[model samples]
Target: MVHNFNSGPSVLPKEVFEEASRAVLDFNGTGLSILEIGHRTSLFQAVIDEAIQTTRELMKLDSDHEVLFLHGGASTQFFQIPMNLLAEGSTAAYLDCGTWGKKAIKEAKLYGNVEVVASSKDRNYTYIPKGYNIPSNATYFHYTTNNTIEGTQMHSIPETSVPLVADMSSDILSYEMDFNRFALIYAGAQKNMGAAGVNLVVVKKDILGKAGRPLPTMMDYREHIANGSLLNTPPVFAIYVAMLTLRWLKQQGGVSVIEKINDRKAQLLYDTLDSLPVFHPTVAKEDRSKMNVVWVMDDPDLEKEFLAICKDNGMVGIKGHRSVGGFRASLYNALPLESVELLTSLMKEFALKKLNRICLRLFLSRHCGLLLSLPAR
Candidate 1:
């Protein structure tokens, strides 16, 4: 079996995949493929409603919040969030911790002033910035909960009176957090939910209409909320797959239980990386992402050999982002612990072989001259 470690469009439960595949062929015995169903049909409506309801149930959200399934991925929210929340002349305090955080900052600046409260860019985002001051006058505090490229994560939710917003594309549903603390939370459906093309949003009801700006029909959160996220045709397949994944998550005893298993998998891989002399993790110990664990060989020259070993051993999507060239193992909810074990075992085997080769070379260097001088053999 292929061990998939893709950062997004990542691994998912086999049961979800099977159910989704069946739906694609013939949805719920309706004799129509999920792909062919109209978005307005009651059948599809049921899918959308259950998805929204299950999302609320899983997060334990109340009537104060509304769940939305939109067409664009989380990146669209970078613009829509500020559009719906940031009024002219107002400022949004952002913690520019990593790539996505930086992107969010850039988008927010288009609508209003953006205060970069804290950043770790100086260290190439090896760690999450902390102890930042959120501006009391700001519209909202924005942050990305996990950095997929840099493999750093914010373990604790920041306490602030200012409204909190998060781009949770890479970490949502992977762990438990205080969902009610955020004024808005958004995520792309690919990482922990489903395939691409859909973005899930949770927004506080009272926060809308406070931005004090005219929003286009599609750009306004209030519009989407009023229309039940059906102002236009949604990504039906993506939402269906996401619903299946959510059901699977419930069957596995929800986020709390999956978190324990995720923790175990991350610990196993990190421990092995620490034990092996050749392999070294890139991110700081305190900030390493449980979802995406990145590491490299101490000797950069051996990266090719190790990657080849990984390929031969049935591992895929272990290559790191281009900006940081190394290995990144994304341990999504569906990735089993045994996959982590296999990767760690490979690391140990590679380290042992390298050590043996070094020892052999040292022995030859020290004794070759003496042996040659004594006699030809």
Candidate 2:
């Protein structure tokens, strides 16, 4: 019973895992396993269709959008997006918040000029940068919706005339938002969605064929839109698992209900961190991420001991990213609230034990000094 809190490839609903497992053995009464079936057959075609349809349904997207399940992870889109939309001589604006945002900027620079409209690097990305100017002449305005490593999130969308592009790899589907606002949104299927190796892309159909340079067929968004994401052999297994997870989300009453549960789970852990004297949350209260809650202890020794206690309690992947050394509790849609409660209880217990040890030390020291001053024993 591992309480998984890993950042990516994170926890998923038990039902999703069970159903996907059954499909691997036998899919919809078909004689062949999902792994062994031909991808072009109607069986797998239905899987891809339903996955796309369910994604749009959950987000309430309209027919103007095209959904794609591509082979590469979200990183590939970092380059593919700029190639498709960014003209050679034009500039694109980006809000640089964390490591991923910086990575996206770097990739976009290779295709065209990139303007960093705003950045939180000065404060080590503790909060999302705001009140920045978006260049009017920029081809598009790009931003990462959630900073997984820094545990800060952009609560509101940035308003601008330019097309909005987002890399929502970590926080998509965890909460409800205006999916129609963005000209494009892409995510790796490992976090709030499902397994790795597949990237889900949603693009406004009209935005295609705008780049200055001609793109190869594979790199072109128009080609993917025309081919139904079957331009090549897709990551069949990963897409199937993602579809199952989407089904589970719909059964759990869609993103609206799931957002409430995620908010409750995040508040449980964050409130516990705030109440405990020794522990402190890393990000500012208003900008903290609902998907990943990060915190650290006052004493390094206590932090180590606390981690040991967490390991003993069947907790896994609670360790923070190396770049930012502190604990990160990822509260994805599938992570049950009980897991957060267990972690918060451990934090209270650990803080109390440390406080009691300090008080006992003070008591012993005072009494021993008094006795020594009065008479030798």
Clashing residue pair totals per candidate (backbone < 3 A) = 0, 0
| TM-score for each of the candidates | 0.96, 0.97
For each candidate in turn, give its C-alpha RMSD to the true structure in angstroms. 2.9, 3.1
lDDT of model 2 at position 72? 84
Per-residue alpha-carbon lDDT of model 1 for 85-156, expressed as tens digits? 999999989999999999888889999999999999999999998777898998899999999999999999
For residue 157, model 2's alpha carbon misses the true position, in angstroms, by 0.8
- Superposition error at 37 for model 2 (Å): 0.9
lDDT of 2 by residue, 1-377 (tens): 68999999999899999988898899989977999888899999999999999999999998888899997898999899999999889899999999999999999999999999999999889898878999999989999999989999989988888999999999999899999988999999999999998999999988888786989889998988889999988899999999999999999999999999998998889888889878888898889999988887766777788889999999998988888876998999999999999998998888888777767666767887632232110
- TM-score between model 1 and native: 0.96
lDDT of 1: 0.90
Clashes of 1: 0
Candidate 2 regions off by >4 Å?
370-377
